[model samples]
Target: MRQNPERRTALLDAAIEVLAREGSRGLTLRAVDKEADVPIGTSSNYFASRDTLLTQAGARVYERLLPDEATVAQQMSSAVGTEGFVYLMREAMTRISGFRTGYLALLELRLEATRRPELREVLTKRVRADMDENVERHLASGLPGDAVSVRLLQLTLSWLILEQLTLPDIMTDEERDELVTEAVLRLSAPSKRE
Candidate 1:
């Protein structure tokens, strides 16, 4: 079947809106069709199955959660000292806060993948690719061969930010910054294993 980018975009946007407003349980073809103002049949035509539609929608949400390479690199580069790191951390936390539902959906998808090996493999591949690219960029900035450490740092920081964003009342900004700073220091410290 010939693809329609505009229609696809519309469907994806509608899916996000539905997922955000209604959560996973509320996702339905009729709801998405109404959200997109497209016919129910059109949604089914574009996405043959609920799994297909949810997976694609979840991917879109994941992409939206992470900043682009250039943006991340620039942030990392400009964030020289501890203060700068805090600024970058705060910015990242803020961005994640803006996409709370998307992040939640991503977490759900990741959990779902555990039961579905094929889905898990696909997500793992994408995550590894993203981590590899980020690791390369971080290494190119004159850091030591700390790809593993850097990847761990990225994952830890991302989860921290997601946690803070999802449950703002649980941690104050100052407390969060202190935690992040401590994590960065420990992760970047000289390692006996290395």
Candidate 2:
């Protein structure tokens, strides 16, 4: 198997584009080759099968979707309290939505996972780990949120993102912004005194 890191990344990125544009049914080695502008058999050298390509493409989406160290440092330095928590969530939403193709590919991977036990196992573990990491980060950041709060906000914002991506006309920008703010405020609030 080819071990050239840069070439592998390029192939995986092309796979992501194909998955996003054509969904799982249309994803093929030839499609990825054309998308990557590589030779017909180039993708096969890096990926042993369509399942491997699909799995790697799913991993690549997370690689692209997660914020880099620099972005995380910047966000952490400026974020404080509930307001900062809201800001963080808004920024996260923006970052995730910005990678439209990556997120769309992720959606396809999720749907595809239903039938592929291997994909389901990998995706379930990855998503669970991501959620756990988010919970730990929220607790450490002094963001006025507990683990449940973080989990709740994650679930709600994900749906909002789906709406934004698939049906932009359903909600105006202001409405979405307000929803983000409200979700953070309500989810992260401390329990009332007995």
Candidate 3:
């Protein structure tokens, strides 16, 4: 079928909302159409089946979850150094905090992926590719971190982000920043392997 990018995006966004609010079990084409406020068949027209919708919706959620240009630039810029790294982490936190619903949907996607190996493969591929790109960016910037180190840093920050946002009173903004800063410092420190 011919495609309308705008309509597809709208349906995917609605799917994300449904996933975040009602979770994977509630992700149906009709529900997506209803969420999008389009006619009842709109989601089906865009997606072939519920599995397709779920997989594409997972991809869409991850796509939107990526950091923007400014954030990427800060992370890639050389003048920032370790301090710049901390700033990048803070910028990420700020953006993620603002996109709480999107993040929730992403978490929902992960939960759904766990039950479906095909979906899990798709997500893990995308996520690992993203992480590899992040490590390359850091290396290109002359930052000190290999893929493994960058992976550790990213995972640490991701868990911290999830907790600080999902669990109230876990840590204040400054406290989280300090924690990430420390992690970055340790990661950037010259290692025997380096």
How many clashes in each candidate?
Answer: 0, 0, 0
Clashes of 2: 0
Give the CA lDDT, 0 to 100, for residue 64 in model 2.
Answer: 92
Misplaced by over 4 Å in model 2 are 192-194
Highest lDDT: give the candidate number.
2
For residues 1-194, write the lDDT of model 2, one tens digit per residue.
Answer: 99999999999999999998899999999999999999999999999999999888888898999988898878987899888998999999999989999999999999999999888888898999999999987788777978998999999999999999989899998899899999999988886851
Q: Which stretches of candidate 1 lie over 4 Å from their true place?
A: 81-87, 143-145, 192-194
lDDT of each: 0.73, 0.91, 0.83
Evaluated against the true structure, the overall lDDT of model 2 is 0.91
Off by over 4 Å in 3: 68-71, 192-194
Residue 83 accuracy (lDDT) in model 2:
84
Q: Which residue pairs in candidate 3 have backbone atoms (N, alpha carbon, C) closer than 3 angstroms, thus clashing?
A: none
Better of 1 and 2 by lDDT: 2
